[model samples]
Target: MEVRRATVDDIDVMAHVLATVAEEGTLGTEPPVDLEVRGQRFRELIEGQGPSAMWVLEDGGRVLGNASVSETRTSGVLTLGMAILAEARGRGGGRRLLEAILEHARSQGAHKVELEAWTDNARAIALYVSTGFEVEGLRRNHYRRRDGSLRSTLLMAVLLDTSEPEPA
Candidate 1:
């Protein structure tokens, strides 16, 4: 699989991957919406020259996953978001996507990259931990599922600038 910066042309397939995962009631907290709506939102992100970078994993002509990191106003801290197609989950696509995003964030001078995962998502949590993230805290009942049940979230982060140790 090849990983590269995402462009507007990738919006359609990216939306499909996100919608599929959202419909599966995993990862994302956003409710599934029309594909065109999702594509439009993705277009805004691609066109906006904001403090964010998005990448897509593709093999042949198919999109396998999407990953992004956006800088927060809290200087030096960037938030990460990623989603992989169910069929591509265990094939190292997620890890490669995350590694690429982390490198992009580091290149942009970010000192830390943070992300949240539903507490019940063991596979994702394992991926994050294995990829160098540490659970910083738990956000109690922060996410509501499609079924109307609330789920807790795990606040995790990876310090990019390893020259200095994270504050205790």
Candidate 2:
């Protein structure tokens, strides 16, 4: 498992990881989420963001997951996003990716880290909880599902205390 900063070349694989993790592949069986759009987002974030870092986890040169940190200077917090290939879930890939991004957040002077998780994704919510994330707030109808139904989003946060131990 090698985690390295992503380049523009990593766009395709990163798109695959996102669509897979987001369940776009299994839900609609239609066109996967626009790879071109995702690729462009990744490109811009990797090339032009401040207090941010993007990384891809590869095994044998194959991308297994991707994660990024977007630091909000106003709030002194870093928001992170992690997407692991569907077939790669529960094998420690997500945990590894999150840990790596957490380290990056600490280096960026972020005392708090946050992420948004779909309320229906119990597995992901559990993962974040186990990683020390606490549900800070909720955003209703944050996203629309394939059935055209609205879903809530959970705002989770983890305090990154480089000075003392994280809350238990």
Index of the highest-lDDT prediction: 1
lDDT tens per residue, model 2, 1-168 = 778889988988888778776664322222457888878878888898566778998888999988888765546688788877776678877788888888877787778988787777788889899989999999998766667877778889998775887599
lDDT for each candidate structure = 0.83, 0.78
Q: Write the per-residue lDDT of candidate 1 for residues 44-99, one digit (tens) a residue.
A: 66676655877899989789999877765668898888888888779888889888
Q: Could you estimate the TM-score for every candidate? A: 0.89, 0.81
Residue 139 lDDT, candidate 2, scale 0-100? 94
Which one is best on TM-score? 1
**CA error at residue 131 for candidate 2, angstroms:** 1.5
